[model samples]
Target: MLAVESRFTGASGLDAMGAAVADALVPQRLQTPDPHRFTASVTSVDLGSVQLVRASAPPMRSVRPVGSPARPDGAAFLLLGRGARGEIAGGGVSAPVDPDHLVLIPGDAAFEVTYPERVEVVFVALDAPGALRLGLAVSGPLRGLALPAAGRALLAPALDAVQAAAAAATPADVADLAEVVEGALGVAVRAAAEPVADPRAAVRAAALRLVDRHLRDPDLGPGWLAACLHLSPSTLHRAFRAGEETVAAMVRRRRVEAVARDLTGPAPGPGVSELAARYGFAGGSHLATAFRARYALSPAEYRARHGSAHHLRRS
Candidate 1:
C-alpha cells in the first residue's frame, strides 16, 4: 500500500495538483475557491489489471466539461466517498456521494463533481474491455449509476480485498485478487441498472464495436464509420456528441494505446518504426510524437522502463 504507490503531497498550485491527479486517476479540470490556500494529496497503486487511487482535498469542483478531450485510455471509475459529502452532475445522471452507496461513472463521460467540504475519495479504475467483460454496461449517455443495496453488498467485500492487497500483497497475489474483483464487479453490474434504451447510445456502441475491429485500417475514419453503420456522417458524429470525442479521435487513441501495449508487453517483436507502420503511423517519429502526447514518454524510453525480459535485454 505505502510502497509501490505514486504519491503527491503539498501541491501549492492548481495546475500542479491537476496534473498529479490526472496521472493518478483520470484527467479533469480542478478548481477551488481559494487557490492560494489550496492543498491536495493523491496516492495511487497500479495492480496491473486495475488501479487504486485515494485523494484528499479541500472544497473544490472537478469538471470534465462537455467537448473537452476525452481520456485517452478511456477508463471508467468506481468511486467510494470516504469523508465529507459531494454531488456529481452531468452525462445525463446526477447523484450524491456518501459512504452508504457506491457510484459508477462510465468511461470518458463528461461530468462535474463538487466537494462541499474537505473530501476524501477512493477510486478503482477499470479499462473499457474489462468492464464490458465483467457485464458492466459502458454504453448509453454518460451517466453515474448508484449501486443498489443488494449490489453494494456484492461489491463491497471485493473492494475491501483490493484495499488490503494494496497494503502488502505480492504482484502475483494482487493479480489474482484483481480477477476476483472483476468477477464480483460483473455480478454487481448486472444487478445495478437496466440497459439504457437511448438510440444515440446504441449507435455509439455499434460504431465503437466496429472501430475496435477496424482499428488497424488506415482508412478508418468518420466517413468510413458512417458508411458501415448505414448512418449519415453527421448522425454518426452526433452519436458521440455527449461523450466529448470525435470518431477519428477515438480511433487514433485506440490505435496509439494498442501500439503502447505492444511496446510494453512481455515478449519483444517489431522495431518502433515497424510498429508505427503497423498501427497506421507514418514512421517511428510520428508514433513517438503521438505516444508522448498521451503517455509523456518516447517509445524507446517507455519500453526500457516498463517492458519485460526481452525489452530489458534489448535495452
Candidate 2:
C-alpha cells in the first residue's frame, strides 16, 4: 500500500482533484457542483489496502457523485465538522446529515453533499479485503451515526496530531500517517460499536460526560441539557426513566459524588459554597444537607476524615 497527501487552495476546482485521487486510490469521478462557490483541498491521501483523505471546503456549495454508481471496490468514512449539512443519495435511499453527525458512504453508491458553510471533513477509504479483516464494510449504503461524547473526546487529540503532521510532513512519512489514521479509525469504530449501552442510560451517562467536558459552565443544568440533546423537558424525563433513574436524582448524585472524590484528595478542594454552586447546588446549606444524608458527614468532616485516613495509610 502507498500514501499520498495533497493540498489545494485558492482553486475552486476541487472536484477534479478528488476525482483524480479517487481514480488512483479507488475508482470514482467527482461530479460537478450544483450551484455555489466551491473550494476544496485534499490534505492527505493514504493508498494501501485502505486509503484515507482529509479534505476541507469553503462555504456555500454542494458536491455529488456523478450517477447511481456501484459501490466502489472500497469503503469511505467521513468525519465532518463546522456545521456542514448534506444528503447521501444511493442504494435507493437518501439520507440527510448535519454537523453533529458522521456519515459513512459506500464507494459504489452515487451521492451528493451540500454544504451551506465552510466545512472540514476527513474521508477514509478502506479496501474490501482490508475492511473485511477489520470486520467492517468497505462499501454499502449510507449510515449516519451521532458521534458519542467519548468518541469526540478521543477524536479531538488525534485530529490535532493529524493537522500538525499535515503542516510538516513528507511524502515518505506514509508509515507515520498510516499509524495515526489507523488509531483514529479504531477509536471511532469502538465508540460506534458500544453506542450508549441503552438510550435511557445514555441520558445520565451523557449528562455526566457533559459535566466532565464542561465543568466550568455555570449554566449547565437540565435546561441546557434539554436543548443540547434536542429533547423536551418531559421527554428528557422519560428518557431518564428508561434508565430507571430521574434527572434530578442523577444530577445531585453525580454532583455530590464529584465533591466527595475531590474531598478525598490531599489538598482541600474548592470552597463548600463554591463547590456546591459548581455542581449546581442551591446553597451551602443545601449541599450540606445532601452530603450528610448521603455520606453521614458534612463536606468539611468528610474532607477531614479523608485526610486523616490518607495520613494513617501513609504511616
Candidate 3:
C-alpha cells in the first residue's frame, strides 16, 4: 500500500519530493516555473502491474522521454482534480488539461506534462497490455482529448475507489482492484474517443468494451453500461442482439474466464470470497453459483484441479 514516505513545505521538501518523484516515476528533470514555494505531498502504491500515485504539488514543468532502458514499459493516465490544469505535448500532438480533462502519457513515447499551477491529480501507470486493453496506447479520436462529460462522470467514482483501495488493500486485493480500475478507465477513455462511422456498430463496440472492462462488477449491466456509453436501455438491447452474445451472457462469460485465468495462473490462490470480490461477484457463494453454472467444477475445486504455481514477469 502507498504510504506517506515524505512531506515538506519548503525548498527542502520540494527537493525531497523531486527525488521521490524520480524514484516513483523515472529519471526526469523538474523545474518550478512560477518562483513559488509550495507544499507537495505524494502517496503511491505499486501493484506489480501498475503504479498509482497521488500528488499535490505546486506548478512545475516535467519532461520525460525515451531514456535509458529504451522508453520504459507502459503508459500513464492523469486524472486531474477540478482545479487542476496543465498541458502535455509529445509525438507532434499537444493536449491541454484544464479542469475539464484527464491526460494520458505514453512512457515509451517522449512527452512533457507541465502543471501551470498547483494541481492535485491521480496518476496511474499501466503495463503495455493494460494500456492496450484500455485503448490508451493508440491515437484514437479520444486518445489525447479531455474526457467527455459522460466519461468524467463515471471516472470520478472509479478513481475514488482505486484511490481508497490503493492505500488499504492487500497485494492480492490491489491486483483485483487494479483490474477493476483498469476496466473503468478503458470504458471512460473509449467513450471520449471519436465515435465510429456506423452509429449502431460504434455503440456496440463501445458498449461491449465497457462490459468487458467491468465484467466483474456485480452491478455491471445494460442499464449501467448504457448510461456509461450514453445509450438507452432499448438501444443497448438492440446492439447486443446484433452481436454474437447477449450482454448478460458476455458479462458472465468474461468474468468466468477471468477468474479461470487467475485461478489457473502461477500464483494459484485467493480465497473464494477474495477471488469473487475481484470479479464483481457478490461473495464466494455468488462466484460458486456462477462458476457452477458455467463450468462443471466449483471455483475452489477447479483451482485445486488446475491451479499451477508459476508466474511470468517482464524481463
RMSD of each: 15.3, 19.3, 14.0
Cα lDDT tens digits, model 3, 169-287, are 66668668778778777677677783313444545655656666666676797778766654568877886788788877777778888888888866636667777788887778888
- Which stretches of model 2 miss by more than 4 angstroms? 1-15, 18-38, 59-74, 92-99, 166-173, 194-315
Tell me the whole-model lDDT of each prediction, alpha carbons only.
0.71, 0.58, 0.66
Tens-place lDDT per residue, model 1, 1-315, is 422434333435677778877776667999888877777777676775577777788899999877665443334677877789998887677777766556777666778999989998877787644554454555444444567787677676677667666678766676677787777776666666645335566566766777787778888889987776557899878878867688877887888888778877766556777787788887878888988988998777777777763352222
Against the hidden true structure, what lDDT does model 2 obtain?
0.58
Q: Which parts of model 1 have CA positions greater than 4 angstroms off?
A: 1-14, 72-74, 193-315
Residue 38 in model 1: lDDT: 78
In model 2, which range of ten residues has the least summed lDDT?
306-315
- lDDT head-to-head 1 vs 2, winner: 1
Better of 1 and 3 by TM-score: 1
- Sort every candidate by TM-score, greatest first: 1, 3, 2
Which residue pairs in model 3 clash with each other?
A: 142-193, 216-279, 216-280, 266-310
Q: Pick the winner on lDDT between candidates 1 and 3.
A: 1
